[model samples]
Target: MLHQSRQSITCELDAGNSNCLTITACYAANLNTERSDLWVDLINVQQQLSLDSSPWVVGGDFNQISHFSEHSLPSVNCYDSPMSEFRDTLSHLGIFDLRFTRPLHTWSNKCPSSRIAKKLDRILVNQPWVSSFPHSQATFLPPDISDHAPAILNLAVNLPTSGTKPFKFFNYLTKHPLFYQTVLQAWHQSGSIAWDLSHLCVKLKKIKSDIKKLNRENFSDIQERVRVANRLLNDAQVLALTHPTQENFLKEKELHDKWEFLRTIEESYFRQRSRINWLREGDHNTTFFHRLMQVRNSYNSIRSFTLSTGEVVTDPVVMGVIAISHFQQLLAPQTTLTSPCSLAWFQALSPFRCPESNAQAMILLPSDEEIERMLFKLNANKTSGPDSLTSELLKAAWNFLGAEALPWEYRSKDIWIQLKQVSEHTGSLL
Candidate 1:
């Protein structure tokens, strides 16, 4: 935090799980920036701080809008000089509006006939802030005393859940009696489209629906089934022990196996939730497993943090921003002077003279077959993505894939072209 006043309070923080410093700030911009110059002062103050790779956030009633959509009332220009300056400052500082989960407008001018509502308040986070808390989100709460609604920041700190989660093929699904048959029916019923790069994406996307339906029919109420299995097993055991018949013993064996199978399913569910690697998977009764869960919740959880300036912060977004700003300052490249000899050497070195054809060949796009093979080769058992997509599902649905599937999710041709552009742009900027 660099400044603190009635209208604004700045805070800097470095909390657990965040390696960088974050800047959390609240700024109440003067209604007319030209009259008060609050925005100008903000820009000047930020100029004094090193912000490379840092995260900074500013939220409050700026009395300004970056875009026309933010302003409810129609205006001739929509962007005045003050709003334009504010937008430009954000662009230069690499700050963006935090992802929020409520209405954009934070203030309301109680004009019953012609309500003049505008997003006068907002939270902005720098790139580093986003990197630190990818699941962070903002929500607008009801305005009770004031006209402006309060915005709440939610950092996804809760344990992961699979409820309505994106479809991913589990190894256990293959054990079902009609697993392949169900998939076959779903595939045959699914309408065919032109085979294109999106074949896998399309097929996978459609398969999720079928999988969901199958799960609803077969996998729901698993615990209830387990209890029912236990009752049946008890009856079979009684007959086996009292009657002492071979058929009764076989029935008892079958019931026990069924109960164990149900229990195994329950274990798999918890193991996935625990996310601890228990190679010996007969049962999950380890202290380490519980400790892992505690650790995850601990590292991810953020109750409060204190800024370098002594102000305590409880908001997650604020902490995230302050940490980002701190890291940006910390990790920024140290300033150095170029030696004359180095400059001379650079001037003497010849430019690359490779043939245009060779350069083009080097940048050529990978073949579809190569890409498909690579996609399948990626490990199937593990998922390391936000979507939780597993490679097993892709491999299983490979035969049902369409040409557009790959392109739907990842258009290699477009991605490669964009990458080349980014590379060239990066060189120029450097």
Candidate 2:
């Protein structure tokens, strides 16, 4: 056991090959004021131990409900102000309830008339836990004598694997000096026959392959690299202290710089994934960002849903089938009409038209300078589109491509598309 208090107790479970798991058993105070301390203590422990990469789980009675739906009888306003502290703490710690089986309410008041039930007990885990135990789940067994149900956490649940994950462009790659070189090399290898939109599409596809190679080579084991770098830096510092030699001091400094560099990269990695813009860089917020990403995944996931036919669907395949069927039915043609309107009826309505100057401006072909400006203005952190093209790639390749003018074949069409996309992206910032 690492630490214990009235509210919580934390411990670490060690496995072979340096794999470790952290677990915390929490039983929070019933009152909001006392519960706040639990939140602070948990956050402090996490920060102190630097357990960002370790699989961690915190389970038991939190004496808190995240949402109003968790309560059998909710407030009229549908807002619980005290819940914010608990939610924010969980966000900061990156803890989320494990998807569970049946009986959502874990605790109930044993009252015959004025009965009350709420999800006061939960098993929450961080992102690393989810990654390590992808099919893990919690089940709330029926309560016997006690009001609270016993929660069972299964770490290893056998399940079919999901298909390929979509490709994403990491903005941190753009900071590396070799990134541009890699893109240029890929572009040369994918030499285009014609400089048109079609050619750009093919070139981008080729670039995506090389970009993946770059990530695998340099950035794939970022967290591991950070750990190794820190270890090396610590060893060098110790050696420098023991030897007190000029060479040893220089070695320590070099390793320290490398460690710092790797840490920055790790921070950027999680920060980008967290999609948190409020917290600026240089705050040592990698842990917070890491947890926030987990929270987002937990929130966005669709573990189970009920169909219109009153059948509960837990299987992803069946859920998808139902979703598609519903959307198809909902969007299907409501009426059968060969001709809904005639030209004469349309001609009776006054045509709303923009000024000639505005119309011309809307269709104006974008210059290379204008396109370059908009591309640079885009958020490089955003994931690449289905085309596997990102703002970072375009900005880096722009210098080489800017010398040539758009091909006359699809110049207007391509330029308009490029301009529209870039404008929309940049406008979003405003």
Q: Name the top lDDT candidate.
A: 2
RMSD of each: 20.3, 7.1
Per-residue lDDT, model 2, residue 207, is: 71
lDDT of all the models against the reference?
A: 0.62, 0.76
How does candidate 1 fare on TM-score? 0.40
Candidate 1 lDDT by residue in tens digits, 296-399 = 44345455565667566766667767777877789764668875677657757976568999989998766768778777676433533433445555555566
Which portions of model 1 show Cα errors greater than 4 Å?
1-169, 221-224, 277-381, 384-388, 397-430
Tell me the deviation in Å of residue 314 in model 1: 11
* TM, every model: 0.40, 0.63
Clashes of each: 37, 0
lDDT of 1 at 170: 54
Q: Which stretches of candidate 2 lie over 4 Å from their true place?
A: 1-160, 244-250, 302-356, 401-430
